[model samples]
Target: MQNDIPVAVIISDNAEKEEDDKLPEHKKIVADWLTEEKRRYGSSLEKREREIIREFKEDPSGVRILIVVDKLLTGFDAPRNTFLYLAKQLRDHNLLQAIARVNRLFDGDEQHEAKVNGFIIDYSKNAKNLRDAMALFSNYDPEDIDRALLNTGEKIAELERIYQQLHGIFNTVRNRKDNEEYIRLLEEDVVKREIFYELVNKFIRQFSACGMIHDFARKFGEKKLARYQRELKKFVELKKIQKIKNAEEVDFSKYKDQIRRILDKYVSSEYVIELSEPLCLSETEAFNEFIEKAENGLSIKSKAEAIAAQTRRTISEQYHKDPEFYGKFSKKIEDLITQLKAARQEDLKALLDTAHDFQTQVQNYEDSDIPGELKGRKVYHPFYRSIVSIFSHYSVTSENICLVVTSLYDIIEKNKIVDWAGNIEVQRKVNLEMEDYLFDVVKEQKSIPLTIEEIESIMSSFWNLAVRNR
Candidate 1:
């Protein structure tokens, strides 16, 4: 325990005498260390020992490190503490209490600023013991454990499917002469050959046990396994060929490079395109904005709620104008219904055509007043396309958008009228329903498990930095 890491042993003063005492050895070890320190320092030990221990117990600034063996874990509160290296085995309430010592809030800290890192040195073989230890302090719930296993299984299943597809493509390509020529060119290019090898090797290693590609060969069928090995060997041979110049050195190097290059080009254009895009700057900006609003104690959820209310108000106003304004709105509604019916059986492309026809009809109407100013705005075409595409292709319900938009349109119409005739009671009900639906969606998307205090601290820090430029 004391080879390189600094050591401290804290134990209950009355560990041997206490009625509930069960850890006598723990007390003895700590007591022995303290006595030795006392002897080494002589009479001077009396002055310094109590003060040093008390200050450590206090754990103020400049306490760079601490390595504990049982003692100070129980009722300790050290805000500056960062790491919790668990050398001793622990579980249940005792383990919970020990880890909690490092989780205390410190000054100028944004909630979880203290990094409670753990290093397990003893229970290396017992994975269950390590998991049980984690359950003491973290949210390692049973359901979470099941979900993690399910995700792992799904990943393995997906990888198995991809391997099968790749093998099918490889078999087809291997029979073709032109594909063989392509492989030759890839072999000639060192960079291209390396890329292809890495692509195969990464997937191979991901499924590999103990970092061995041989594990993949043993698990999958021999035919596909042989192909991977064959291709991989070709790649390595090409790498060697590129460096060789003389007749003896040239040997099989040129042949290997030529074969590998052909295979590399095929894999890239066919297989790699299907993978999901990595996070980009636009996504980062969206996330940063969200975090900023959270830190400022501002709620996008609440703003959306207010928008729902405004939408409802506009709908109420629009519904009040007699058969003149009302008639015009009803026409748009009829057109929407007609297009929706067309979209029901149509695919995305056909649905877009139907939406375009309806929009074109609206444009042709001599009575229309949708404003030329709104035409060709970047969002207008996209918004219309999204509406049509989602209605025709995706699973998201279009009723939510219609209910909110229609309600808002009605409210705007009502406000324009000198004398309103639409039923106020009906508008109120629609408004309430819209609010309920919008709030439910917001809650489903944004709800988190942190305490209110914790959330506020995180949001504040996030916004201060994120909104600084905005």
Candidate 2:
């Protein structure tokens, strides 16, 4: 009760035969627990059952233990239930159902390690009963059941193999203690980093399994187990840094917190890297602030990679915002990374400078590209660009293009009713107005050689762009 860990003693103590103090110590303890349970819910059987079950099912921290005789045996389903303490004897389907209580698959988010397997701690001497039931349950495949029910030794052996393979990733780093060298090796080879992620995940799963399988973990010995904890910690941190160094999405394992707890329990937490969500590079100030913070903690090379990853993602997402501008800087980032990887540009400062330059260009791109006449004209800007692009071969002045933007915008703005974009009649009116402006004003007077096909193409594109911008 003091621990604030809710325990549900789901037994009907409606009318006990003996007094609470007179009962045996264990039973008295249970009686005292039952008394609290009754107190909490106040003699309301329906409320008690519902509240207890609700807490146990929904709240991960609530109802850590449920002293159920058999109420939950059949219909109750809790995916988080990973352990079953057997104290009573049963046979066949009843035994199978009881064991199945813990057999439900469990998955965890970033706060918990996934429960890879269920555990049955038998105090009822039910091993023979379990095997007998499984064997005789003719509905189940004997071979399948045998494969699913792993004994302790098998789990330990599997853990050993996986742990060895996990450490094998960094075997090339001559100084096993040097984290930088390990990171450097991963930095050079992306494939090795991928392999490390997969193997480390398996190792965590296998290690988690061996650690939970009763007393069998003792066979790993104190020194060997300590070594495992240390190496696992090192690998987990390495995996974390590499993910950042490469600018991978923040898909850190749901099991990280649970694994961290396990490691912190056994080892020191000295070399841990904190994870922050990947920021949007389009949010220039936010991106700048985030990078400023990274500058304090991240290495020059890592900071560069982080910047590049973020910039590329933003360019992809905001490409529609300004494809011509975004694509230009996107190419610049690609070239810098290629040169760095090819050993042509080893200076990390150059990468930083390029990124800084890109930031300036993107922020000022609107000011420089949008003429003073069309300044603050958001819809007219793209329209003007489309005119400039479509009539690039002709000698059209910025003033003339601005006039075209005004004319086309007025036509679209006037006809844009509730569903004007989809309404073909509204579209035809817009296209005809645009065609008249493009031909009589631009082609006839300005002599830009704008043809029928070009006018139609411009109308379709400008209509779509207007639909989006407006």
Candidate with maximal lDDT: 2
Task: Compose the digit string of candidate 1's lDDT tens values, residues 1-470.
Answer: 35553444443344335433454776666556666665876734445535545555454331235555446655566554545556556766666566566555332232212221222233323335536766765776766544422243444465566455434434534433343343444434666555544444434333331112224334556675456545544433332222211001112221222223323443453222211112122232332243234322322222222222222233334333222333454455455444543443334344444433433333332233322433433222222222223223334344443432344333334443332335465445544543443344322443322344433332232222222211
What TM value does model 1 have?
0.23
Q: Estimate each model's TM-score.
A: 0.23, 0.75
Please list the C-alpha lDDT of all candidates, in the order they appear.
Answer: 0.38, 0.70
Q: Count the backbone clashes (under 3 Å) in each candidate.
A: 35, 1
**Candidate 2 local Cα displacement, residue 352, angstroms:** 3.2
Report the Cα RMSD per candidate: 22.7, 5.3
Backbone clashes (count) for model 2 = 1
Q: Write candidate 2's Cα lDDT for 307-368 as tens digits.
A: 67666766677666555667777897788667555443357777777766765665545535
